[model samples]
Every structure is written in C-alpha cells, then in structure tokens.
Target: MSKPVVLTIAGSDSGGGAGIQADLKTFNSTGSFGTSVITCLTAQNPDGVTGILEVDAGFLEKQMRAVFSYFPVKAVKTGMLFSESLIRTVSRILKEYRAKGQDFHLVVDPVMVATSGAKLLQDEAISSLIQELLPMAGIVTPNLDEAKILGSGEIQTSQEMKPEAISLSKKLGVPVLLKGGHLKHSAEALDILSFPNGESLSYSKPFVQDFNPHGTGCTYSSAIASYLGQGESISSAVGKARDFLHSAIVQSFPAGKSKTLNHNPD
Candidate 1:
C-alpha cells in the first residue's frame, strides 16, 4: 500500500514552527507523504515575524507544476500566499487541474494576519483571494481575525461565529471552517464548520495553556487535509484532526527564544 500524498503551498518559516514547516510536520504526523511549494520566505521566531520575501509568481508556478506533474497529490493545502499575483497564479493552476479531471481536495488557510498581529497578506490581495481562489477551495479555514477581515466586522462570540461561517460558506461557495482560537475564552477552543447545504459541525477541545503555540492554525488545517487524503469524511477528518492538534500542542516544544515548536511524529 502506498502512503497518501499531501502537498502544502505556503511560506517558509525559518523559525521551523509555522507555514510550510508546520504543514509538512502535521502531514507527516497524520501518516501522509508531504510535498511543498513555498510562496514566501520569512525571518521569524516565536516572538514575531521580522521580515518577508515573496517568491516570484513565475517561480512559484514552476514549483507547483513540477510537483503536480510528477507526484500523485491526493490533497493540497495553501497558506500565506502574500500577493494578488500569487493568488491568481494558484487559481489558474487549480482551474487547469480541474479541467484535466484531477480534482484534488483543497484546503485554504486564509492567512491574513500573523500570530503577533502582523499583516501577512497585502491589503489589495484580499479581494483577489475572495474573487479567485475561495470558490475553488474545498475547505476554507480562517481564524477569528481573518474571518473579521473577510467579513469586514468583528467575530468575537460563538453565536456571531455560526451564522458568519454559513454566510461565508455561501458567499465563497465552499465549506468554511471558522477557527475560534483567537477568541477570548476560558473553556475550550471552538471551531465551526459550515457547508453550503446548510449542514454544520462544531468542534471544541480544551485549550492547552501553552503560550508558545506558533503554528497551531497551520497545523490544524493541514492535518485535516491529510486525513481527507486518507479517505475520511470531512466531519470525521476534522474531528480527528482537532484531537491531533490538541495532542501536538500539549506536547509542543520550546524551539526559539519565545515560541514552542509543534511536535511532528515523523
């Protein structure tokens, strides 16, 4: 039997706790073979991101094409595509793959703001993302801040989060996973998954008291995609993935001066 193949299209985290590094770690931990197409390079640590250098759109496309041309990718997850050009290029590739009847499961983590409140995506790129790529995504995972950015308002409570998830799913024409990690809460981290068919699932797990969790959002979405590549239903995959992320956070390591590194069982 061959291992399921999962590809991550995201940025390079030199800190080794987030972006492409974290995605690959989550994929491997979930029993999938991982591949990556880096969109940007960042100088960052647990404290914050110091700098960002985006890869040229042409080179980024080349990397994606190279992987798809040779590897049998079962699923693909995207994070931190910094520019409108990169988003459009990725949209084109997705269209090409679909036209060829290769409909790989796609998980899009709309990484607009960093953990330390730095704006990761360009202001002009948000509209392009919604117009081009959101509709093509199988699942869109947005943290509270990203959701607010997308919705143009604050989503601070679970009641406000539910309808917004459904509305975003309808607006984007895909399932929406509204992550509740950024909410000010004490009980548990609650995430809502809403589909276009009016079906919704809510997942909650005890929030680990680890302030050093750096790549948690990236890890969670990629873990879900890895499970989907292994033929699990979306709801079940998300539930299991949530459990996996909790474990990873619980066993997280202090990697840099301030942040903790996600554990990869690979």
Candidate 2:
C-alpha cells in the first residue's frame, strides 16, 4: 500500500517548530508521504526570528516543479511566502498544474505574523496573495489579527468572527477558517469556519496559554492539510486538526527560556 503524497511549500525553520518542519511532521502523522519546496530559510526559535534568507524566485519555482513532476500530490500547503514575487511564483506553479488538469487540494495558511510578534509576510505581498494565491486554495486559515488585516476590520469577539469569516470566504471563493486564538480572555480557544456553500462550523478547545505557542498556527493548519491528503472532508479535517493541536499544547515543554510545542508528541 503506497502512502498518499502531499507537499508543503514554505520557509525552512532552523528552529524546527514551524514552517516546513511542522508541515512535514503533520503530513506523516496523517499517514501521507511528505514532500517540500522551501521558499525561504529563517533563523528562528522559541524566542523569535533572527534572520531570513529567501530563495530566488526561479529556484523556488524549480523546486516546486521538481516535486510536482514526480509526486502524485493529493494536497499542497503553503506557508510564509515572504515576498510578492515568491507568492507569484508559487501561484504560477499551481496554475500550471491546474492547466494540466491536475487538481490540487491547496491549503493556504495566510501566515502574516509570527507568534513572537515578528512580521512574516510583507505588506506588498498581501495583495498578490489575495489576488493570486488565495483563490486557488481549498481553504484559508487566518488568526484573528490576520483576519482583521485581510477582512479590513476588527474581529474582537466571537460574534465578529462569523461575519468576517463568511465575508472572507465569499470573497475568496473558498472556505475560510478564522482562528480566535488571539482572544486572550476566553477560557477556551474557539475557531469558526465558513464554507463557500454558506455553511458554517465551529470548534473549541481549552485555550493554551499563548505566551510561547511557537508553532500553534502552523501545526493546526498542517494537520488540516495532512488530513485532506488522506481524503478527509474539510470539516472532519478541521476537527482532527483542532484535537491534535490541543494535544500538542498539552504536551508542550520548556525550551530556550520559553516553551515550544511537541509537534510529534508521543
């Protein structure tokens, strides 16, 4: 029995908490063969990012093509595409696959910010991502702050998240998962999902102290993509992803003066 193939096109995290590292772990945990195309290299850790080196656009495209050329990729997840050019390059590759009649189950984590309060996506890149990359995605996952930026308003309460998520999903022509992780006062973390079909779903988990949740977003989104790679429905995938992420938080341990999640917890 061959494992299903899935790909993660994102930055490399030297810290191994997020980016390509987290994606690969989630993919394999869901029983898929994980492949990757690195977009940038970030010197990151539990504390913060120190430096970043982006891959050349041409080389980035080449790496993507190399994977698509060989693997029967059932799902592709994108994260931390730092520049407009990089986003464009990734979008073009997806378009090529689409043109070839190869449907891609794209999971786009609109990763604009890092847990350490560092900006991961460029201001210029947001427009290109909105116009080119997001439409191709089967789903887009954004935290409250990111949703506010993408949706153009404040989503301060659970009530606010629904309309914004529905609005964004309608605008993007795909489902949207709006994470309420930033709602600091909530006893439990909540997330809302709005599908293009006008249907909505909600999930909640005991809120993990967000202080040093190094890869929470990455892990959650990667889990969704991984489950999708195994042919799970979007809602089911989201549920499992939430549950897995909650467990990761439970198993989290201290590292480097801060705490980091157990991406592949036993």
Runs with alpha carbons beyond 4 Å of true place in candidate 1: 259-261
Alpha carbon deviation, residue 122, candidate 1 (Å): 0.3
Residue range 1-266, candidate 1, lDDT tens digits: 68989999999998888899999888888899999999999998767889999999999999989998888888999999999999999999978977887758999999988887777899999999998998888899998888877772577676787888888787778898999887787478899999988778899888777557678889999999999999998888899899898878777665546537555532
- Clashes per candidate, residues 3 or more apart or on different chains: 0, 0
Predict model 1's lDDT versus the native: 0.86
TM-score for predicted model 2 compared with the true structure: 0.96
Per-residue CA lDDT of model 2 for 55-116, tens digit only, reads 99999989988998988888888999999999999999899998997766899999998888
Q: Whole-model Cα lDDT per candidate?
A: 0.86, 0.86
> How do the predictions measure up, each by TM-score?
0.95, 0.96
